[model samples]
Target: MSHSIAIIGASGYTGAELIRLLATHPSFEIKALAANSKAGQPLANVFPHLRHLDLPDLVTWEKIDYSQIDLCFCALPHKTSQEVISKLPKSVKIVDLSADFRLRDPAEYEKWYGNAHSAVEMQSEAVYGLTEFYRDEISQARLVAGTGCNAATGQYALRPLVAAGVIDLDEIILDLQCGVSGAGRSLKENLLHAELSEGTNAYAVGSTHRHLGEFDQEFSAIAGRDVKIQFTPHLGPFNRGILATAYVRGDSDAVLAALQSAYEDEPFVEVLPKGETPSTHHVRGSNYCHIGVVQDRLPGRVIVVAALDNLTKGSSGQALQNANLMLGAPETAGLTLAPCFP
Candidate 1:
């Protein structure tokens, strides 16, 4: 049976990405499209490339009755998702592609986002939506919170090693570079065509990036203790990918074996052959994440790298993966599209 689905913030990058992937999805029916500011307009008017699909016109949340919807994709921004999700029908399962529910502790959420969570009750009920790491929880959850794009990339490289105790928990360092789309569709002077076209620069330096909360949460959970990693993110000229390099203290063989063994059966995450390295170009525009592990020249150290399309595997794709699990459908349904290449 086809499940009815809605895209709550349908005018942004991840929202449009959800539409693109769901358009060809076999068991998911796009039933509702909502965007507060763009209400009453046709979805295609805002996203011309999606003119071929049949989707509801942009409507205000108050205009649609949630009774017919089986699942919702909350793609709104931080803080906004919490408020909007709090008002939705209780029975509808949600895969929020926002920071609203990713952090489990309300205090942590406030610490990183600078606002008290308005939906603590629901926040307590959400499952982190890193499909590879939280499959069991997501399969049984009514609300699955997606990870930050950079966070997802970083975790894919280091989580397995951390879980296996193959890497030194205290020595983790991540250097990540992300494409422009991860910034969202908002207009900003720094993101203009002229400014970003030929330059590459870093931001959120010295552990100032917010996704560190995710690394702190997941890494600490796996180690059963406090774990912190130095993280820095850089903006690149490309439009859609993330490449993260994690410098860890561990045997290269053990790190490789751990990642290969952990993701051995998972469909979306793959540990590449030895000596190989991940690149954003390789996994661009797909739900797939490619990870590579190698030994550094210095003994007792390993260099782990992972690549993925931030908008897909990092956000909407992960959301759909969780939705499939929640709806009791095949875990990989509507998500088999391979990475785009030249």
Candidate 2:
């Protein structure tokens, strides 16, 4: 129950979120907070909201000794995590919150990331961190890869259907809208308050977004064949939450039943009754996903909607879930907080 943990890239949005969750975690101690760019600064200076918590000051990654840390949460940028994780001691259990290890295929990782995976051997050892489906594998894993925020949302609305054969996997279409934080804390002209506040638009149209690799891997595996879905993600002006609407050919009642049956015993996923849809605000700031389904106007079609805070259930919170499994702790530990509603 006594586990020492470190967050490798502690200066970003997701890193701060992880710190907030682990602050309430009973079995773990936050031993190190590393941010190469913000070295020597107090975490309060970088993330003022977390100033209330007593935490380690930000330092360079090299200053922390992995020999003393039992688990590490890698919140580094896509290509950066591979480099940093490669150098860590093998004894440290890793829950990588980046795209680096989610794909088992090193060649596919290179294809989407534009660089060959330097830790190809380690990549093969990492387990996909989809907690519900990969529970057994992740519980015994030393290194686990968290899914993309958008990818996780889409799967929430559709994976059960694919596994139960309740929906037409070949015709599934996932249209997702995500909050600004999903884009990260970096400075981008389009993300400025002036430009992003008033409008919402879609990016990564067609099959171009990097998260498609995850959908391809997951959906195909569940159906026991090659199954691909049309996925498009939109950028919303809000600060948190993601709402994914998936259109599939299926019986509305069966889809609802499948979701409820799959997640009723689970802590994070909530499946609403038929005809009731979900809004992102309801699940905002919590490690919960609310899913609902209704009959589509087109005959034999159904619309499944799922909502979650992209930063919570989709990223950091998910990283913590996998870590709990990896550490033999309760899967829902430190993650039972109810959604914050106005």
RMSD of 1: 0.9
lDDT of 1: 0.90
lDDT against the true structure, per candidate, is: 0.90, 0.91
Worst window of 10 by summed lDDT in candidate 1: 56-65
Candidate 2 wrongly placed segments (more than 4 Å)? none
Give the CA lDDT, 0 to 100, for residue 327 in model 1.
Answer: 94
Q: Taking the tens digit of each residue's C-alpha lDDT, what string does model 2 give over 1-342?
A: 689999988999999999989999989889999999999999999999989999989999988988999999999998889999999888889999999999999888877778999899999999998788899999999999999999999988888999999998778888999999999999999999999998999998986899989998898988889998988899999999999999999899888889988998998888887899999989988999999999988889999999999999999999999999899888888898888987
Identify the candidate with maximal lDDT: 2
Tens digits of lDDT, candidate 1, 126-205: 99988887889998898989999999889888888888899888899898999999999999889998999999999999
lDDT of 2: 0.91
Worst 10 residues of 2 by lDDT: 105-114
* Model 2 alpha-carbon miss at residue 272, Å: 0.3
